[model samples]
Target: MMAQWHPIAPGEPLRAGDQGPRIAQLRKLLQMFGDYNGHPGPVTANNNNPERFDAGLQLAVESYQRRHGMAVTGVADKATLKELERPPVDLARQLEVNAKRWDKLPDKPGKRYILVNVPDFRLHLIEQHRVVLSMKTVVGKSSKRTPDMTSKVVSVVFNPTWTVPRSILLTDLLPKARNNPEAMHRRGYRVVKYGTNTTTPISDKSIQSAARGKATLRQISGPGNTLGRVKFIVPNKQAIFLHDTQAQSLFEHHHRAFSHGCIRLQQPEELAYALLGPQGWDRTRVAQATTGDESITIKVANPPKLFIAYFTAWVDGLGKVHFRPDIYHRDN
Candidate 1:
């Protein structure tokens, strides 16, 4: 079947009414994944336009795209084609690699635990082996990958201030903010002499001092705060955090590896309620904490265990095998 169906030539995508070997190629490719359910027969020369991309084929392509967390355009776009082109052997090898990682987990992790599959860009709240809550997550980019380690989520912090990470301070923001101090002002950051509560005015000298590692910045907790409204604290030496992000659009992306090294959640309010409920906080209390000037950190008496793992291949709820692009290249 590998040789029987190959990636459709990467050019103009195969769309409705298009016909030729490319259409036939897409037809076969979708069928291979059980995405195509119509016209199982072959496209023979004697037939009239049997290879045309029709409504059925378009629907199948949409189905396949949706399952893989891709834009559901109902066309053989480049991204879709690229995913289809993954060699079967490579997929098999990835599955084998993930199997070893999966083996590290206990047979019964717990009745309630958090599973953040980095490569999958998803978070699952599994209780009794069932997904009680699921949401899209943005992880660290490849260069600064979200760590693969297990810990316990001990608390939820709301209206959190951003103590800008050192890496981001030096690499992403320093140089620009040095010349245009307003950059820091616009983002609600206060320049403070490093290791002190003393706030410095937005001045080129202050920005330069910060850039030279003489000072630091902390973003005030408010509407446009970087950490959104809440963050889950995991007691790890790496200082890793699972937090809410103000960049809501990032969740819509199929490959959500944009953060420096934190896990950004799409539905922080929902998760906050779930995690803090046992500790006497409800939806209203959680929502209230997100506003106002005060920052709040509440400890979870029965904190859920956390498992942050990299899995490029896994089975979905419908017993269908799914594969994510090796975004972190751990498979490599």
Candidate 2:
């Protein structure tokens, strides 16, 4: 039966007031998924008013998009239509995945711990198994997907310098630097030899070699740093950590999976305070620490447990089933 749910032909999204057979199919699908109750807006002779993409149907479509972690545009977008066409994976499969994750969860994930749900693009501060705070998060894209790992947040660095990753430098920055000799300096980057402690000015020829993975480039800690004003350090081999981004406007979008690999926090200051308040850190202290060009790192005696997890579908506390897109296509 699921085999027949093929994607509609590529075209502009079906917005409100649009009436067609595609809208009819969408209405049926929404009703099947419990998003459409078929009430409060309009009533036709046949009861199931499928042809019209009215306000009620638009609301249901938005709700479906929200549950599936898609862009909640209230229109039948290409991505949304594609998602509608894809066959739903069985509940048993989702339950199996959730069970494994539950088994791996620590007995006491610390008195205060941070939970980052990769697929949900959300971060929650859990204290005693109850969420005390929640915020939006921008995770990595499909190509450079954010990984699932458990670690402890040991420290927070303010005015942090961004060390250009070898992968990014080799692929993105090196080529740009080769063309413009002053590119690195203009972008607040300082070049250094990989092994030695010597930091020197970057020459045009040196930039070419660096492109070939020969040297290291580190950005200076300042207003325009990619790491923003602060970052949370979790000791991991993958070199992944939580940090702030200068682009705060991205958070306005519903589907925000735009990053290299590190998780981008929507409210970095609030998160810092949540983790550091126990250590006598406050807004005033954070401001002082972040005032200079130098990076300030503060150690946490009782670091919070950090769990980066991915769950495409799960049952909420109220027993409502919530489904999200397999953004990384991990659930084969």
What lDDT does each candidate get? 0.84, 0.81
Error of 2 at 283 (Å): 2.5
State the lDDT of candidate 1 residue by residue for 166-218, as single tens digits.
78888877776776778679878888887787886668777778877888788
**Per-model RMSD to reference:** 3.7, 4.0
lDDT of 2 at 251: 95
* Candidate 1 backbone clash number: 0
Residue 5 local lDDT, model 2: 43
**Which prediction has the highest TM-score against the true structure?**
1
* Residue 23, model 1: Cα distance from true site in angstroms: 3.3
TM for every model, in the order presented, reads 0.85, 0.81
Return the TM-score for candidate 1, rounded to 2 decimals: 0.85
